[model samples]
Target chain A: MATHRFDPNFTDNVINSMGPKTSPRLRQLMTGLIKHVHDFARENELTVDEWMAGVKLLNWAGQMSDDKRNEGQLVCDVIGLESLVDEITFTLADEAKDAPTATAILGPFFRADTPYRENGADIVVTKPKDGEMAFMHGRVMDFETKTPLVGATVEVWQASTNGLYEQQDENQVEFNLRGKFKTDADGRYYFYCLRPTPYPVPDDGPAGRMLQLMDRHPFRPAHIHIIATHDGYRPLTTQIFDRKDKYLDNDSVFAVKDSLVVDFVERKDDPQAGLELNYDVKLVADAK
Target chain B: MATHRFDPNFTDNVINSMGPKTSPRLRQLMTGLIKHVHDFARENELTVDEWMAGVKLLNWAGQMSDDKRNEGQLVCDVIGLESLVDEITFTLADEAKDAPTATAILGPFFRADTPYRENGADIVVTKPKDGEMAFMHGRVMDFETKTPLVGATVEVWQASTNGLYEQQDENQVEFNLRGKFKTDADGRYYFYCLRPTPYPVPDDGPAGRMLQLMDRHPFRPAHIHIIATHDGYRPLTTQIFDRKDKYLDNDSVFAVKDSLVVDFVERKDDPQAGLELNYDVKLVADAK
Candidate 1:
């Protein structure tokens, strides 16, 4: 019988042949990628059908992507890859004792060039139907010094209570529920918006099919996304999850960090019948 | 700083949630896939840019694939995954010691229901431009008995010397280099065709870009594909490589098996002005 055992030199041959003259960083990345992927296939004894299924899923996800939607990013998020990579790469240096705000995946909905507004500006241009108003106020501070970071840029966005971003729903005004605000002299920023509600990710695409096949829900917990930046501090991108959202413990993207969850206090007497949430952001110093 | 170390339970959480009610085999597969992918990301400290680049590559490959071309399959082939899986899954049973023919990937080009032709029939319906003629003859035998298997279906195909398959080139007639022949009572089958030539895989897509980035050649060695099937014997799919082909040692797909390589002898006096090749295929029985 012919030898069917694993070839000892296969990995080396593939790596050496494919990575000879690329940039050093590219070579290193490719080598590690090849080794891990090859080892995974061998260890799993992956069958042809399984491999073909994976290819088909990826193909479908690609086909589903468009200028406004990124199905591939959704796939990565659903598979927990986006969050895992974010966690790994955003780890703070050990010497910094104070805890900075945790990082979250910059999901596919982010759009640049949002119009800047003064602190405490109401971001909701058209009130969403069946949506309860909410006031999200937060303070931006330096992690090391505990000093307020005045004039910090706080970019905030979240899906409507209907779980659709402005770009995704034609009924909503352009850039609805999206705005940029500056921290006041007291280092506080606030925006009036609809309370986020737990919603399923787009379920009509290949990523949704993958989630279904995996027996997992496609829901992400109610959350508000924020990107806070100051001149002398590292940019902080994170999401604040409502403490009462049912999907918090089982966020589809695995992006819910304990420190990023906050409670929204119900303010029944308010004219808008709004909820109030206060969160504090801490940014790491840019350098030693 | 907050704990940024690897979440010890993260792997288990993903696996358990994603695989709760899936089939046992699927559960096992998903579990392994999640672990390996997460571990690979963490180990490589994969940057966001690198991850997004991979996503873009996959997206491009999917967009490039359609009914006629399989860019995703090409990606798998160039990554050496198709051949690796074929090798692992096609290993012969230990008890059936007689060496059966080796297997290769059923590439994306294979189409079912090809028309059958009589023995000694020439498969090249249109003489390819700048192509050298070749006459290929082979016998199908039972591995254990060394006896001919009559009435076996021998399907054959190959790219022209110009490195184009019939479907790929408009000038070539439909099914030009593709045909099926039946073995005679002596288990012999013969067909006239062009000598297979080394060819670059379609390099205008994502897979090609990957090859270029890796500093690797995209050429597959010269080879002929055959699939032999008899009523009571297991079907054998394989490729016969031209021993003199320069790419034999470094086929883009890593499909060059030592046992599948053969010499193509030149015939000076033949009317066809062709090369002659003889291959004997040994098929294992269906059951003990």
Candidate 2:
């Protein structure tokens, strides 16, 4: 009942409005959210114009979002919220030295129904003239037992040299640079595709405008998106970065993990030169 | 640069990522936001499922929003952030005894082309069969001078007895229960319309689903929405609640202020009985 003083932080009033059927967990979450948000507005002494600007930005994000795009999620990514949640939710405890590979954002570009392919197959349906193919191979293993995870499904996708995911660039064929492979008996999976390139998060919308206002570049590091999964093990969605990419340290999405960065070795005069990248992934067993 | 320990609260890392050209005000605002949002997720020990649920909820809100509706804003309103911002931004310093009338949310229903009618014209184009007419009049005044603002604009709109605005209900005549009037020489404006009714906020979308999860009712109280404006004084957009409405204390939007509540006197068998509801508005002069 905050009255007279115009103290709209009637936190109790709002909390009290909850009905008896409300979930205790939701109550706790809503309580914390209301307190922090109220404090944010009050401490900032946020003006009408500023508040409305935030509202309009969110509205713009909603308007710009659709099947092939998610401006709302992009807002979270650029603000570091998505990465924070990923870290908090998926990061293993420090007590475990043999943790699984680090998790990364399942960015907006991921699409379902990826074509399945055999080992050492190429995912680039039609490689660009300017693109150079890279050899990518890895072993998926069980973390605690240090054994190979036979028959694990490994899905991979990457941007073309132009930095646009296939779905975003109409000129590219559907499912270009995207595929899934079942690991061999030794837990090995391999594929050939154009190397991932640093790219901007879509900036034609409100979230992109935020980067513009921050004077921050929207480029994510050159990284291959991967998902390794097998029954009885936790599915890991992650990105492995080319260590040499300029955006590694300051990824627009704040999603880079030290353990997830690997060198795309260079062998100038050899056939395999600048063409090979080996990344082994470990999976944490799902608690029985 | 939080690393190894999975301390994603990399507050400085994200803050430092801002470009040198970022506005100082935006930097401060973002720093506060990042800290608060991160603390919220971390303190709650947020899980992947829970975080994803939030992301999905926001996505649903964005997808459900368009020209006729703004689910993102509804999310803010149901959470009380909009009201808190309005209070903090518009509430004058404690020393100003003659402060302007309290402000309220310019809810999603406001339309730009409100018909300009003479002082006593009725806004109800075609009255509902079950509706009872209410006579509403208001005066606009300068707070400090306590003088009438002749020719001030008084715009009013309210929900019909069925709890639907014109645009939301196709069956209703256009501009029903909405009109704008210029004050008479005495700063008086009047219009007849159906009495306001308590109504639920749009609950089919994510914001409404949130209220359902909280076991909270989505209804706002019976009230008349008004905006008083003149050449020099600050415009006051506010709501005057009917003292007898049950939802007055638990308004879904957290917008009911003590200073803005009024009793809608009920008239006996007499023609003029229970019909008179007069409210006066005060506006602070815009600072030079």
Candidate 3:
């Protein structure tokens, strides 16, 4: 009998080791993935037949993808890999520096170019009675100074009064319910657009099949998108969902941060305002 | 800026406040699994979409399962999870304790009922000309006593001549090339079976698709399966693959152990032996 030490890479003994040298980051990621994947297999006593089935599904997912839609990316997001990455990114930030406003999955619908507009300009985008007219005004200010940061760009978009994205609606005008506005000297900016309504994501693709399997709905609450940016301030790509939305708490993307949920107030018979809405503005500097 | 402690489980924030409440073994395993899974999720920046996709894949894997076929298990084997468990299981014994022959993947095609035969019986299983007959003989000795152990059952199976498993081949007879042999008083046993041929796994399924995606081929070398057991002996489930097989260094399941490879020698014109092929075997007992 011979004394022996356990070899960690026992599998490499028979299979000629030919893997490329991996960077620290990739090694860490692959190691972690392999361990968990291995554990999952052991816990389930996964069989060969079952494994092949997974391969087939992944292949199908790849085949389902096209230029217009990335089913693979959608699948990756649904599996919580995207959120996991976001969380890791947040963790890697310096403790002294607060993270930027929470980032969410850009659900494969954001367009590249949005028309810019002047401050206080009406970005009504379209004329539709399905959505209520709301005036949104906000200011970008230095967090410490409490002073508005003038000349900041605020790009905004929202689902129509019917709560469906313009891209999903062939009848809706292109870029309807979406526009860009710049802040005035006082760092104030206002826009006119119908309030967004809750709507379901496309349920006809492979992602839909996944949702059906989990018995989960694919609805997102009414929300107004905003991409605020200035020279010094960190670009804030965020959205504020209507607190009154039916799916406010159960947002499909898990993007509903507590601070990002806002109540839509109603004001009637305001002769001076000349509208049934009172808009308010607030600004804070980026946390250091 | 405020100083913050680098606390683990920040989001869940569920510290193990109740200390020492569980067995150390269970606690270690649970903690290890949690950390591994969480780290994997973190490293992958796994999005909600990806998470859902994984979950959906799992659910679909379950849906595609049947009593006779388990693709999940096969995946586990291919990824070497089962082999890892087996290594942990057998390596617990001290080095002075003889190690049993290495165990490999049982694969998804094995069955329980194989014909039991006397010592030196022929288990040609298929047509005589389908594959070359090999007269295999081996001794099961108690390493401590250096004595042969008789009355031990040796189970064996292999792929047919056409590189296809009985489970995968509708044309092959049930339990083809499968049998169990008991050792004679001399601790030697021999049986005739068709030589195995390298075969590809089911390529039409998800597992096949995964291989395609990764640009990997699915091929397992020709091998003879064996599980030898006797009273007070640790059971051994191992396989002896032909050394000349093309897939020897590239087994898909990572089941090929260095010590498990054996050569099949050609013996021509041996009138006394009346055999054309021969091979030797060595096995260590399982320490109690």
TM-score of each candidate structure, all chains considered together: 0.92, 0.94, 0.56
Q: Rank the candidates by TM-score, best first.
A: 2, 1, 3
DockQ-superior candidate, 1 or 2: 2
DockQ of each: 0.60, 0.70, 0.10
The alpha-carbon RMSD values of the candidates against the true structure, listed in the order shown, are 3.2, 2.7, 9.9
For model 3, the local distance difference test gives 0.60
lDDT of candidate 3 over B48-129, digit per residue (tens): 4445455444444434445445565555555566565555555654356655456666666667767788776666545635
Steric collisions counted per model: 0, 3, 48
Best TM-score among the predictions, by candidate number: 2
Regions more than 4 Å wrong, model 3: A1-5, A11-32, A35-288, B1-26, B48-61, B94-100, B128-130, B268-288
State residue B76's C-alpha deviation in candidate 2, in Å.
0.8
Model 2 residue A149 distance off true place after TM-score fit, in angstroms: 1.7
What is the alpha-carbon RMSD of candidate 1 to the true structure?
3.2
Model 2 reaches what TM-score against the true structure?
Answer: 0.94
TM-score of 1: 0.92
Worst 10 residues of 3 chain A by lDDT: A271-280
